[model samples]
Target: MRIAIDAMGGDFGPRVVIPACIDALTRHPHLSLTLVGQQDEISAYIPSAERQQFADRLTVLHADKVIGNTDKPSHALRQRKQTSMHEALCLVADGHAQACVSAGNTGALMALSRFVLKMLPGIDRPAIITAIPSRKGDSYMLDLGANVDCSAEHLLQFAIMGSVMTQAVAGIAEPKVGLLNVGEEEIKGNEQVKLASRLIKEHGGINYAGFIEGDDICAGKVDVVVCDGFVGNIALKSSEGVARLIGRQLRDGFSGSVFRRLLGWLVKPVLQDIASYIDPARRNGASLLGLQGIVVKSHGGADRQCFGYAIDQAVAEVSMDVPNCINRQLEKSIAIKYRLKRSP
Candidate 1:
């Protein structure tokens, strides 16, 4: 499979993206990588020896402009053919590559993806979906920062898209779906939440688990959690912050006095394991669900390891044929709802 990388996007740009692409190429012999960025900068970072080793599978496509971190989404759409981000996305849309991976500005990537790849037939808008690690297992969440204000119909659409992807990617037969809200009771939450609940429950394909709270997300009570981007993005950032704080506090506590230092040394392996489990870089990629083609968005501040996870996600999605599976299952669910509504 071939994957395109927006090498000039993100905090480190080519410095981080290039290493991740090289590592992926080395790890997967059958895979080919196309780095889309300025030729000189991209080549400068890669050593000549290693470049020759993988010359057969590695190719760099020069792009003069790059989408800035603060570039407006509207402005990005206007310069479709110029930016590296747009060209990387076009690689997927044009069938030149199996997927496109970028650690670029989230807003610009979303706007460009929807325009270039178009939305699946029945999807109203594209959503950002990622796997959130939890105690019981990993749960899939959607609208991380895509549609801020979603209507009942949009929430229902998100559920269908999330459910289909969860099933295809996670291999869950009927993934349990939950609506994130302040309380789990039917009486709680805004009118939109209540109405969305009813719509999800009525859908024949979705395994609606009713409403779930913020705390329930890490508890892994449901397989898929659905929310608007406004709430989902805040929740995601807050969780990342809390994890860093707790990890720092623990490390500080362990390094205090002689006895504490001795104990810390003995438990270093355990702490390392815990750190690995909670590491954001270990799980950084998010799929722009509902697009016609595969596009994985890496975190804007991602390093080589973090960005590599994004490439892994793209590879997995491509192998699973995620877009085709989602399109079929989504239309099936919509048809089921229509039939039930008309049955009298």
Candidate 2:
């Protein structure tokens, strides 16, 4: 499978993108990569021997322009037609690549993707879905930032999409869907939450697990959490911020005193493993759901390792045929729901 990458979109640009592409090619022999960026800059990162190793498997497309972080989403999409990110997405749209991954301005990515690829049938809006580590394992959260304000119908659609995505990516069967609310009670949240709960409960297509409070997210009470992008974004960022704070405290405590220092040396390996598991850079990337093809959005500040992980994620999505599987599931569920609703 061929994966298209926006090499000039992230903070590290070709320096990290080139190495990560090489690493992915080494590990997955069948994987081909199309780097979208300035050809000269990309060539500088890949040595002659390494280039010869991959040979025709690797190709670089020149994109003289770039989308900056400060540019307005609409303006950038309109002005920077030759941007690396836009060019990479064009590869996917034109069937040149199975998937596209970028660590650029998220707004531009979202806007361009929606405009070029369009939304899936029956989906009102595409959601930004990501896996969040929980006590019971990883849980999927949708509308992470795609839509700041969403209607009850929009949220219900997110629940359906999130449920299918969790099953496809997390290997969960009959994934339980939860509506994020201030309380676990059905009537506790705002008008939107209450209306969404009613629809979810009566929809019969999804495995609705009632309302879930914010605290229940980390507790792993449900496999899929659905909320408006406004709320979901806050929850995701809050969890990430807390994790970083804890990691800093651990580092300081370990080096603060001799006794702690000895303990640190003994448990350093274990701590490192835990930190890696919760690192925002490691889990910061997300997929734009409801599109025709796979599109991964990595953190703008992602390093080489983070970019590598994003490539792995893109490969998984493409290999698993996540979009096809999700579309099939959605069709079956909607069909069943329509028949049931007409019954009695």
**TM-score of model 2 vs. true structure:** 0.96
Task: Show how many residue pairs clash in every candidate, following the order shown.
Answer: 0, 0
lDDT (Cα atoms) of all candidates against the true structure:
0.91, 0.89
* Model 2 lDDT per residue over 236-340, tens place: 999999999999999998997799999999999999999988877877569999998899998888888888888988888898888888788778868977898
- Model 1, position 308, has a per-residue lDDT of 91
Model 2 RMSD to the real structure? 1.4
Query: Among these predicted structures, which one has the highest TM-score?
Result: 1
- Screening candidate 1 with a backbone cut-off below 3 angstroms (N, C-alpha, C), the clashing residue pairs are none
